[model samples]
Target: MTKKRIFLLLFSACFVFLFYRIYYHPETRARENHDRTRIVTDMKGRAFQVADPIRRIALLGGPTGQVAFILGVQDHLCAVTNTLKMSKLVQEMYPAIKALPGPRTTSGNINIEELINSNPDIAIAGDIDGQIVLDKTRIPVAFLEDGMGEGMEDIKREIRFYGTIFQAPDRAEKYVAFLERVMHLIEQRTRDIPVQKRKNVFQGFSPSHLVTLGGDTFMQERIKLSGCENAAETVTTIGKRTGLHSGLAEVSMEQVLEWDPDILVINYGKPADLYKDPQWRNIRAVRNKQIYSQPAGVFIFNRPTAESAVIFPLWLAAIAYPDLFENISINGIVKTFYREIFDFDLTDLQVHDILLGTYEFKMMKGIKNRG
Candidate 1:
């Protein structure tokens, strides 16, 4: 009885060892790791399966191409939308992108044949464009959040998502930390300002002086971060669409006179235009000559992008309350951020031009307003 039991136990042990050696060997584990696919859930809550080490990408959405550049994955881009190409600031930073193929227009029109020829490993896009690309091509598509919502978390969320997709989490975390530092600096400086004393800001968008951003867009985030109030905060998102001018709404001249913001940061006409125009003479911003042109960098701060999320609030704070930020050197900050994060060296004159919004004016010259 004892011999029989011992022999059976030994046989069972041998079978267990053989099974472990076959399935859990080092070489087998390595092969599984190499071939394993990852599932990523986009902001829209759709799940997508992506293969490891994505080598080729097609950016088919707004504000994402610039983010790819931020993540240091711009070299892997095989196709992009026309929005990036249309941005004069982007052209200055990454001139090589001019040669890249734009298979999708910013308006969500896709040229399937052109996109197929590009043969990207993955397509990162907005909901509509992403679905269209998924339907038309065999390539995997990852959707992104279209609007930036009410605060800073959404911006960070998008960046981290891109980091995962690009396999550059370290780089993305580094950028996020840097962004938080800048944001904290702005908050510390402006936190002490009394709510009653904070200035009221109105953002006048492009194409028409009366066209402005409402409280629903990222523009409100910029104003609030700068320790100021958005005079247009009461404007509803009744007619908002999902595109370049998503949360923008047109207000009547009577409305401007009613709000009478203390400062007007515009993307269109100059301060002088407001002062001379009889229709705007009674507004507090015009009466006090507190009009300022909004700065434009890789893209206009009309919407949120990685660059805007990091830099726009700081810039706006400096403009809204120069006395509070007297000790901080915004010029140096802008120069360092562009040089270090963007890998683009900015001259002192270039920094000055950007701060004063002259750079935007120069780039926009002769180009009809797109809004």
Candidate 2:
């Protein structure tokens, strides 16, 4: 009798536990039936169960700001953690960015008091800690798998989601269409180029041999799209997860020598002082005088920010096949993007410089490819 009772009790407990999980599991949470499913956002095991397609927002990073504008919700943005380097459009709308502040840490992360003061309806952040911040703020925070190294599709999906949320479905559809069109143009332009004729790429982070993008990075993928081959393609090295203090992958002359990349691409802000380094001289890239310095903000993944996504591909197209799209005029691209997304015109060179990474953002975009 005791054994039978015990069995029954255990079965009841299991049933209750499963019932609780079935209802409370983050994975099973569902978004509105009207939401589009073009892009599958893997929300760290939690599905993007967007309740009301989020209106008044608080952002923990700059990308959300860009996305807000892209989705035609520049006015809907209630607050953003002020550490972001804002584009001219954002700066104009929220001049309060100069006064905004936030916590910069990897632990016990909490939302900024100012963000709470703004009384946001929704929150957007990058990590679990950011979610903790939203929890503190008492709002639902959407954590995106963000980075400069993220795929173009991932970015477009984000754009689509933001568009859906802000009731700007037309803008989102157009944005995705434009991205596809631009990418197709770039691909068609380089389709005829043979492997040998293409550039051999070495993505560098520092003049010091320590700098590198791993096999899986968006910048590396961009290089591939531009008809360039990454020197680190065959290497078995992985990079550190820290901000910009990225560690090395077994520093050795032979590894660089074996790659013999024709063009060395480093994130902008690296002072090219490596030309003075004796150790850097032995590098085939250095020897061939093929080292190229990217604009300050063009790195996307290894450097996680929104600016890189806008112009990083343009930089890749310019460097990889200078002949096809050489003049490198961003005026048209910039003008179209501004008009399409925000209905704003950024004509000031200084503003463009800051937005386009003419200055150091002090981070590298992530890697988009693995092999």
Candidate 3:
């Protein structure tokens, strides 16, 4: 044969061999099978395809990490919001969380380049522009509408969505069952109480004590489920300016005085601030020292996280009507919850910190008052 013909035969054979290795090789086919994408719908009903073996995840918006942690998928997180990264409780339990890539704020103002570098397979956002994420990063965006609806159902829906993504539906159901049990227990204890006897509770947001949740907000459902009436139920308008929470509304000091809540649950700020402030001295919660701070786990319990949805109501009921929940051990429940849901055993000190609220515990620990 001619040398040219021989060379051509060799080149053709090499091309065929490379093609077989690239496309028909068993390892290559196996990789394709392992990395295949599947369609799943987010809580907002937006359908997107995510890789089957999701190795990395980015949680945008505040406190969404609570769901991932509850599902035992915290190890898969490559990025998280600054709020979660700075959480003392989370940092203690999942030390790696502090080193994860995160945005400065939890408002969904993400740094696209930073997120791109983290190389997450999917980005789950609770409050963000989903289209911007999709166009800029080409990463599938799952919009979590977890806290937007009524109380426990909204939380259950969010957990189920994450469960589906992580292929942990059984674990999600386990958490949901716990929530139902807690709610049932609360109902059984509080059902016979007359409206006149139920506590009038006010949910105060952080930074500004005047900013409170109204009936239009999801917190109203939380308050009701706890067997208390919302003090701000009469005020239906949302606040003109955003503060710690969007559902919060600005009420006049006089209005708060008139409502005269029997108990107060503040997300931030010391109860002493209200007690000492002359402006609030006459308020029933302040005068009676009935103010209780919400707990802080992966996130503040006041937010619509799984921990909040499941535990906050019980915590609220326990505090509001100690006589009714006297036999229930909140500390024991908290310990078991951290163990089973997050797979992290809590020291008594850690549980105390969570129950006392993040800011309060930080104060107790001599940590700076960042809140």
Candidate 4:
């Protein structure tokens, strides 16, 4: 047989062997028992080894820094990129981070001298590029993938992974429990909505083009949980295979008019507003006063990663079925989030602007006194 044929046969044999080992073997039973004792996840979302980690800290990206600050372990950060700015949410919670020192990571050229200067025990950035950068620095780098588009459960597992690495599994367990409690309640309430009533929602891309997230995107999952149906989430499977998802489909305005969305919930700020033009005024959503603007808050759209997932669902739900979930408190969730995860207090003022699309934006100013 040719090499391709030979390789295919080997792969088939391995798959069969692995399947047999998983389903029928006595040893598999023993391994599963151990897995149950510890938190574990595999590359394919399978429960596998419980991650055990110990560390010094290095962060390579802005979002990683964002998450660390949210976790109340900003002190654990040994290094980060200098370009980092505090998000409206982070500043709302902790304004003291302006003084921290971080090194920026670039791909084209390596900064050997600067790398030598920041003596970090571990490099905790979100990608293999971080590892490559750390490798040049000759430091032990732990590459944490920035799972911005991952589902709620996946985000939780990564948080748990961080806790595992930091030897703070209890903290991870605490986060998991809090997430589960809120999610369980939301799921139960929305279980009654029939298929037809689910809102046909359309997401906005960064203003350069008409690209938007499909149900495959992370934020779309939030849209569904929040009681709205994504118009485009069903159209593409682009985000799943490749972790780096961007450059959405170029759709025409005419197509959007055909969809006749009940509400136009754009993830981007005023710039992504499709209904801004005179031609769009005739659109049903615009005519019905349903065109809504989403200002960038704690993080950007669909970045339902880690702590964002906590607030994301609530924010989406509130927007989708405000009447059904008017009583549900984002402030209460914020308090629980800070108390349980960050061990801090979030003011109602922070919660107000956060949902109002004014917390953190480049152009618009937010109301400081939310109450």
Candidate 5:
């Protein structure tokens, strides 16, 4: 054969070999890895053997889904709860998330049929209902504790838990380090502020403005961590009963008027509603326009999420004590958070829109704007 023909044949053979190694080799290795299983202990202290790679996941809670998204394992999410589907942040950040199938219930109850049909390798649920899931689909269900008593630590653990589950322990560790750094910074900045000087904050949840968080809730810890005292701390009804009732409770308007918080933080109501209301006008927060709506990101900042564990304290501290944190750049913190955690490159406008909750996405239906 001619030397030219021999050279061309060698070149074609090399090209074909490279393509096979690049495409088929990795896929074959992935299949081999997927078949491997390992035993893991979930937050509920239950042990189960899960796929090594955990290629598909079903999230039973919105916050859990946010955690997965933050850990950069969202590509593995096969199914999510309806609440996550309704989240404005999720809609904006991952438009494709809406196309995924969701369970039937809105009350944290997973639909067995939908979950089975989705065919996730494992499932992460908010509550410890593993038997129900196991009985139905034979899928190992890992329970993630809702952030309540431990505050920031709980969120960090949740992040690390999922990180381990999805084989992204390095990413989880990085985020935990970021969380600890921010927490330490806030602590150092506000540590010396005396109890008497801390801002008294009232976190209103419902339209009635009567349902507020108690001291034991995550929001209360967030407030305290931000160098502010919860105004509703005096309310004895909250956290009195067991279960979820302890986190939130109803209070009368007279009781709130008595508390007379220095700052009002509403999770679901417009600023105009408080500013224009006759009863609220006399309150210190309303009179001074100190009422600030909690910013909603992947999950509501007022609520618990890994993102909120870091971001909420910074945002609240800046608002509560501006002079002390004047040197801290909240905008920079937010920009870095989105870039690192969500892997989304946000422009200045996008960052502002998230902070202000005015990104022009559809507001969660039936939920009033707290801004």
Candidate 6:
């Protein structure tokens, strides 16, 4: 054959062989099988595909990691933010998670290089910045709605979504059912309490800045469910701004004094300082020592968590209506919650410490400390 013809033929043969290897070879076919995935529409209405058996996951923001833990799928987590690692219950239950690498913020702001290096099949992000994850990484990103300001239905929806993604729908449904039962039981017990009898509550976020729970936020719902009225429900603006917002609403100390709340619930400040502060001495809660600190578990009780949805209201109710819920033991409830959701048994002393806000995992030097 002519040299030109031979060269052409050889080139064509090589091209065909490369094409087959790239598209039809056994390795390619195996990869195609592994890539078999399903579409999931997140809370923000963004749709994305994830691997069929999602083995490794990166949780960005929101309580996606916590929800995953609740659904019994935390074993799939490969990369988690610093917030998840800092969770007292999570560290206690899964010590190995302390070594995972990722970002630290809950706003879906992550280290792209570390995240990509982690090789997570999928990334779940909070609704606020999920799009950033998609823009920055080759990994598939799914967004979950902000659970903090949402209701129980939203929590259940997130639970079901995580369950479906992890192929654990049954477990998800069981948790949702448990949440429903707990919510219903609290409602049934406190539904008929007179409004006049319900305590007026002030939720403190800090010492100098006294932020209270607004009526529209989930914290307000929690306060109401606990048979207490939010002292700041009437304030329309936060931090002197004229607009609605979720989470803590910054109010003046004068406004708090005007509301004159009967009970004080603090998340950031020390109860002792509040009680001793000369400026706060006149508040009813301070004089009576009705101040209570929000509990911290897998996550802070003040923030949203699948676990907190059940525990926060119940704990608050027990405190708000002690005469009615006197039979409920906060320690027992904490034990049962940890036992049922996490399958981690807690000693009575541990439960007591958790209630007292002293339950913390010994700080471990791990991925977080590494440069």
Q: Which candidate is the best by lDDT?
A: 1
What's the true lDDT of residue 350 in model 5? 69
lDDT of 4 by residue, 1-371 (tens): 89999999999999999998666453333334332333444233434333133223556655456556545466666555543333556555556545544455332223545544544545565555465664565554455656545787777767776665566667778778888887776787677888898767666554532556666567677777777777776566443333334424546677677777777765455633555667667766677776565534555444555666667666666666777777777678767777677766667766566555665453123222321
The TM-score, computed over Cα atoms with residue i paired to residue i, of candidate 1 is 0.85
Clashes of each: 0, 19, 0, 5, 2, 0
Q: What would the TM-scores of all predictions be?
A: 0.85, 0.70, 0.85, 0.73, 0.83, 0.84
Question: Backbone clash tally for model 4?
Answer: 5
Which lDDT value does model 6 have at 30?
31
The lDDT for every candidate, in the order shown, is: 0.78, 0.57, 0.77, 0.59, 0.75, 0.72
Sorted by lDDT (best first), the order is 1, 3, 5, 6, 4, 2
lDDT of 3 by residue, 19-110 (tens): 99677653344335454888888887788787788778888867577788888888999878767776777788888987898753536467
lDDT of 2 by residue, 199-249 (tens): 787766654545676566655666677767777875534345443243224
- Could you tell me how far off, in angstroms, the CA of residue 148 lies in candidate 2 after the best superposition? 6.8
Report the Cα lDDT for residue 177, model 5. Answer: 88
| Backbone-clash count (model 2) | 19
The total of clashing pairs for model 6 equals 0
Error of 6 at 208 (Å): 2.5
* Candidate 6 lDDT tens digits, 1-371: 99999999999999999998677653234336565778887777788777788778888763557776777777878788776776666777888877888563546356776776676778787645567767765677777776446777888888888887788898888888888877887888899998888899887864454866577666777888778888977764323422112465588889889988898877655688788889999999899999877665666565567877888888888877788877777678778877887778988866765665553222212323643
Better of 2 and 6 by TM-score: 6
Scored against the true structure, residue 73 in model 6 reaches a CA lDDT of 73
Candidate 1, run of 10 with poorest lDDT? 25-34
Tens-place lDDT digits, model 5, residues 45-77? 999887776788888865667877777888888
Which parts of model 4 have CA positions greater than 4 angstroms off?
1-56, 82-84, 105-115, 147-149, 237-250, 267-276, 295-297, 362-371
Inter-residue clash pairs, candidate 4 = 58-124, 80-102, 80-103, 214-233, 215-233
